[model samples]
Target: LPASQQEHIFNAAWGGSHKTGQLICNACNQSFSTNVDEVFSLYTTAIMNAWSFKGQRHKSVPIIELDGDYVLEAGAKLRIKPEKPLFEEKNLPNGQIRTKISFNSKGEAKRWLNNGGAESWLGRSLTPEEREYLLSLIKESEPQRREPEPQEASTTLNLRNQYRSSAHTILKCLGFFLPDLVCSPLTQPIRQFARYDEGDWRLFAVEPEQFFSLGEEITNLLGLGVYHNSVEIYWSSSSRMIVGILTLLNRVKRAVIISNNYAGSDKILYVFEDTNLSKKPPTAILAEIDSSKFCQPLLGVQYFAQPTKMYEYFYNELVGLTSIYNPIDAMKAELIKSLEEVNKHHTTLEGSTIDQYQTLYLNFFIKLGKVLQVSVDSVKIDSKLQEYGFSRLRLELKGRNITDPEVESIIVQAFDSVLSDWTQNRL
Candidate 1:
């Protein structure tokens, strides 16, 4: 927690300690909890991400910065409170709003801006190069290239058959075709284009005539969305073809179905996430980002540009052996718990002190992190021993090779699987 942390909407320090908590979004009318730190991280990342990408130009290169203050609506209060003693909206010592409320009752926890920065959700900005680098971190498995726009696609039986054949041929080429509609100028299938929304972050806009034209191209080019190698053909008279197209596309990708009703095409552009050029999938060549709790908010804020956030995200993605699929930082956290148990028995261990029983403490907790298979990064021991004076126990997280070769292979495979699942195939 920082000295100036605050939560207009709750900035959850949720997972650091394990008492359990609550996140209540009054505007969204939603309240839920799993672990505090995990949830808050996910929320911050997702929401801030929206601010990062929204309203920016879709240049060949990304300008990694906040999408401006489009998301900071006044009067929005996302609060996280201690569910144990009944939910309470916490306040800072100086009576400031501590939106990222802390359970420890520490004076530091306040708002990101209190330390002096931008009028931003994350309170800071990144340089052009760094921002571009972070945007690349978004893992685009397949990068989409822009070419001269294809003409209005004609779906005559012959053309449809040819397109269908072309689709299969592309599959044989070992990848799927993706249809990302850029609805800036708003011409064709504007309604269906509107249906595709980016929830947390915002998007760049498309030219007007490009709307229905893109929809027509998608209708003719890839058929409808795929389900396995088979394409999904949908047509309904309900609400216009625009509404019908949206209704169907919603079932195909939830990430595109935000904003309830389409908000005219002044500000939305879709990215076709992936397509492999080898080994055709037997199923729909899926090429959309799965709705991520991590991406929703963080991209929208300036804080994501900070060094601290960079380290935190890196720690999770490259080093997190626990949080990927589990969502709850449970594994790393579960292993950390020995400290709490020690805290109970030993009672007090804070301030400038040293542990007298250095050897005993190390010997007992030494096997703890090893058992969990994650390194313990710097453990502090307080209390002065007889002549040596108070000593600190510092253990930096170290990556070690497992002694057994076969077990090492299995661990590596598990790690690979986790990485594959968590990473979005976007470019």
Candidate 2:
């Protein structure tokens, strides 16, 4: 038995007088039979004793960096215990509350920041840019309304004056005007100008008109509310039109719906969601005839030609992949060849790192099939390993190949159908 260094034999006597003796192990302070057979069993039992494992304190240790090529199983569960918060709120001299937190671990902090936690949420100190932008908004504006004369307010403030003061107080208390404090603006529907020739039709708003004329009889007839998309169809009068015109243009290439309130025009604008020109235009077209010469384009119409968000997302993905693997042209070529082959086979393929190649192949395959007009049931992209893999170094597709003659021919036909579009797009 393994014993403490302090262990020593208490006593030992080998003779007939001490035929069956007791042996003392000073380490454990326990006595055992000194008879040959029993002593061997006692020593064996002590040596073979099982001790429960005492693990190190997990809270104090930092997480080790994960391997770049580490592959995790599909059912893997990752647990991350957050570190102590490093920052607290600190009031600034300018009455703005700043964060006490500074970037102690830049890499980890950056990752945390990128995962939708703004610096303010992290209680991090503001950058100079943020500080300047905030300061500009926070600076008080000169009062637009005239102050009450001393003679007029002999006692308490009037109701109007009280309301203004209350509003100002509320704005300050709620931090409505503070940078990054307000809710995000509402999402506007996609807007596009239907260009037929030199003249293009677009949605426009009329000059802001009061819904309730303050002192006029119309005030009794109409309640106060903001008006939107109020356009003049004829020289006679202006009326409110439903934004349904956008939906009509999306569904049908051509459709005419009468506007009951407005007499002169019944045409709706045409706006298709296509990214290319050769794609067949939707069967319906919506166009409006404006007999009134007074209709003018709204402000900021010239800057509406930017690509849709989907395209931007695609660009971002490509840029990210390029950054990870430099000389992207080679990767692009390899990807194109592999994607074309996958399209040609019309079968599922497994990838080493499922996230990257799977996404890339599925997107390309689906899009290619769409352009070719062959609607497949689903794009197949399986993982090479049953579990999830993180490494992205592998390029070759390394799984089962579809050998069905009929399916292969069908894929070839689809590829041939979109060959022109593919070639043009590749260039």
How well does each candidate superpose onto the true structure, as a TM-score? 0.17, 0.16
Per-residue CA lDDT of model 1 for 1-30, tens digit only, reads: 221321111111211111111211232111
The sequence of per-residue lDDT tens digits that candidate 2 reaches over residues 262-304 is 3333333222222112222222233344434435411111111
Candidate that would win on TM-score: 1
The reply for model 1, stretches above 4 Å from the true place, is 1-365, 368-389, 392-427
- TM-score of candidate 2 relative to the true fold: 0.16
